[model samples]
Target: MINVKVMAVLDLVSILQKREIAFSVEDGTTIRGLLEIMCSQYGPELEKKIYVDKDKELLNLNLYLNGRHIHFLGGLDAVLRNEDTVLLIPYASGG
Candidate 1:
């Protein structure tokens, strides 16, 4: 089993109902797989906030793995390791 912690900021705090969560995933699970697990646990309210096009793609949420953006690590395919910390921060735009 792979153990990880998730830190959520902004509106996600309310959506998830907590600022931090302890999560577990199977070994070799990827970031996308983690989100899928969360979706199953949290249901559509959480799913709608993160996925678009019926879960085909990620929405505006920004995912960081151990302080580095997942976009640079390997997108959603980035393999998770034990004790990894995944930070979720929604994209914000202001003019």
Candidate 2:
């Protein structure tokens, strides 16, 4: 199994309870799969914040893997490794 650290920002703290969590996923699990597991644990409220559709497409939230944006790596398909860190930063809009 691979150990990953997940950091949630902004409103996500309400769902996650804590600012960060350590997750253990099966080896070779992609970012998307890890997120699915998290959603299941956190329930529907978190599911709606992260996924845009039933297909589990990521919403507009900015996701970073080890301080690097996931979009640069490969979006949700980005493979994770032991001790990798994932940070979720939600978009803020308003004056």
Candidate 3:
């Protein structure tokens, strides 16, 4: 198993129930796999908040791995490692 540290912004604290959490994934799990596990653990409400589709074709929030944006790191196929830090930042819209 690989242990990852997940950090969420204040806007997502209510949904996640905590600002930071330690999550365990199977060895060699990719970002997409990790997201699937999280969605299953957190339920439909959280899933809807994160993904625009079940296939993960679109994302409603920004995901960072160790302070680097996932978009530049091979999207969801990025492999995770033990002790890696993941951050979730909710979308913000302003006038």
Candidate 4:
């Protein structure tokens, strides 16, 4: 099992109905696979909040695996291990 912690992103919290969740995934599951599962479990609205396009080519949120950014680890292809913690952080912009 892996744990996912969703930061205080209102839209996402509303969709997921919780700030943190734990679920089982097949061993060797990648981050992309995990996101896909979340989309299916929560709904397309969750996908829209995370993905930048219908093609799912870009991520609008920042993903961290056990405190390290996914980009540095291996982007969406980063493989998850049992008991790993993935944190989802929303992007913020103001000027």
| Local accuracy of candidate 4 as per-residue lDDT tens digits, 1-87 | 554443435556778888778868888888899899989998888888899999897998988988899999999999988877888
Question: TM-score of each candidate?
Answer: 0.91, 0.92, 0.90, 0.86
Instruction: Report the Cα RMSD per candidate.
Output: 1.5, 1.5, 1.7, 2.2
Candidate 2 regions exceeding 4 Å error are: 93-95
Question: Highest TM-score among the candidates is held by which one?
Answer: 2
* lDDT (Cα) of model 2: 0.91
Q: Give the C-alpha lDDT of model 3.
A: 0.88
lDDT of 2 at 5: 98
**Per-residue lDDT of candidate 1, residues 7-53 (tens digit):** 99989999899999999789999999999899899888888878765
Kindly list the per-residue Cα lDDT of model 3 for residues 38-68, writing each as its tens digit.
Answer: 7888888788888888876799899999999
Per-model lDDT: 0.89, 0.91, 0.88, 0.82
Give the range of the ten consecutive residues with the poorest summed lDDT in model 4.
Answer: 1-10
Clashing pairs in 3: none
lDDT of 4: 0.82
What is the lDDT for 69 in model 1?
95
